[model samples]
Target: YEKSSTILTSNKSYGEWGEIFKDHVIAAALLDRILHHCTTINIKGESYRLKERKKQGIKTGLIRHNSTEILEN
Candidate 1:
């Protein structure tokens, strides 16, 4: 980081990141260096996991009008 720039992306927020890094001092130091020369971008959108689940439901006929019969027949 000192010799070159770095970029990072996380699904967790800053306040929720302590749980991710699992070390207070390390997390704080890393965050300090990152925030020192970084442009933080907060991307808000539906979770990719949920979107994939919906797509899987459509593919598997889980959301069909006759889901059970579609499966049996």
Candidate 2:
């Protein structure tokens, strides 16, 4: 496995992964192995779950507008 390519996916960030694994040493070891030849990609955006709810006609209520003058004041 060490000489082969690999792919991994996780919803949690690296910092949160320590807590998720419940062992800092093991998490570090796991990361070291997985990341050895990995190309890390960070994909960040609004949750797909929320988008589905919106399409289902979920009421999100009014959108707030911010004025420049309010910030200046």
Candidate 3:
């Protein structure tokens, strides 16, 4: 996929990947490869669902968040 773009999304922090996958070595390696050339779009919990609810004039139970942080290597 050279010259093509790849986008990955996640709500959990990279540090927790080991716990989620139950393997620190593998999780770290996977994270390393992803960070090698790809960009990380760190999106918070609000996501699209929360955004649409607000746009439709609905009151969501939880407070909404808005932002995306880019992690580049």
Ranking by TM-score: 3, 2, 1
Taking the tens digit of each residue's C-alpha lDDT, what string does model 2 give over 1-73?
6676566778787778779989988899987776665577765655556777788999666353433221110
After superposing candidate 2 on the true structure, give the runs of residues whose Cα lies further than 4 Å from its correct spot. Answer: 2-5, 57-73
Assess each prediction's global lDDT (C-alpha) against the native: 0.61, 0.67, 0.78
Q: Write the per-residue lDDT of candidate 1 for residues 1-73, one digit (tens) a residue.
A: 4687566777677776677888777878877766875566665644545668776764433332321111110
TM-scores for the candidates: 0.54, 0.63, 0.64
Candidate 3 lDDT over residue span 1-73, tens digit each = 4587777766678999999999999999999887787767776557566778889989888764667677777
CA lDDT of 15 in candidate 3?
99
**Model 3 bad stretches (over 4 Å):** 1-3, 51-65
How displaced is residue 2 in candidate 3, in Å?
3.7
Model 1 vs. true fold: TM: 0.54
- Candidate RMSDs in Å, in order, are 14.7, 10.9, 3.0
